[model samples]
Target: MFHMNRIFRHSHLTPYEADYAQWCAEQGALLREGRLSDLDRENLAEEIESLGRSDKREIESRLKVLLVHLLKLQFQAKQVKEGWRSTVVEQRRRIRKLIKESPSLRSYPMQVLAEEYEYARSDAAGETGLPARVFPENCPYDIDDILDLDFYPQAVGSAGGQSDLA
Candidate 1:
């Protein structure tokens, strides 16, 4: 049970927070019966925004997973495992599905690709046991190449990359 004594916060809980199932039923009835004025507009709007945020998070998370494996595939080619390819394929498919669902977010992946690469670089380095410098400072692959299911760099890692770790 939620504590009502917590000060500075709302002393009262709305139907949405206090009893979600009942609130949903009420809202559904309001919508179905064409009772627009009786609907919880504010909560509905917030729920819509929350769904968009959830989709964005899903795409970005999948992109991060793709980046990590792609970095491994590009920087530590000799150490590549079948599991990495499987992960790459899965993440790409999932990311593409999210973008397809929300066309407005089509450019979102490219916009945040570099930022996601930073996380990938760190994770790849740790996973591959190679220094972060072994990978490019910025994302070397573009959105299209990353998304391409057939794309996999044949060339090996950086020159003198000390591949002993891989």
Candidate 2:
């Protein structure tokens, strides 16, 4: 699970610089691995900052794209992505224990757990190749495997709660 404080802090970085740094890191790895894309171009800091102010879906889309590039680098490095599949199980178990011993996670939504394990919605729901139809309490869903998450553009301009509308 991400510490709320850390997530809050991480979200506050100068958006453009952060995005540019992420791009540089991923692109550098691809270049070293002999797979540099000519289409990739550096964006001005102002543009990236503008992206940060955009809607959540847009932000998530950009983040997901950046994550894919990072995962490619990790795959090239032969680094197994186990945090989701491994740490999530243990964390969930601990949460359960804490709940049984006292009573929590009631105040904490399950979505927080899902995000903590970096679970993509489709994978957590087992719409992908996962064996189960839903994410088990201890099971971790990989966010990297989700390639085409869709977002409804109309939802962006509305101030109403999306879940409520659904």
Among these predictions, the greatest lDDT belongs to: 1
The window of 10 residues in a row where model 1 has the poorest summed lDDT is 1-10
User: To one decimal, what is the Cα RMSD in angstroms of model 2 from the true structure?
Assistant: 21.1
Instruction: List candidate 1 stretches off by more than 4 Å.
Output: 1-14, 155-166
Q: Which ranges of candidate 2 are over 4 A from the true structure?
A: 1-84, 111-166
Give one digit per residue, the lDDT tens place, for model 2 in 1-166: 2232222212333333567665454444444555534214455444455553443333344333333222222222233344422333343344444445544323342334344334433333342333433333442323322222221111223465431112
In model 1, residue pairs whose N, Cα or C atoms come closer than 3 Å (at least 3 residues apart or on different chains), thus clashing, are none
State, as a TM-score between 0 and 1, how close model 1 is to the true structure. 0.79
lDDT of each: 0.78, 0.35
Candidate 1, 110-133: lDDT as tens digits:
988988989988988999999999
Please give the lDDT score at residue 126 for candidate 2. 40
- Report the C-alpha displacement of residue 84, candidate 2, in angstroms: 5.3
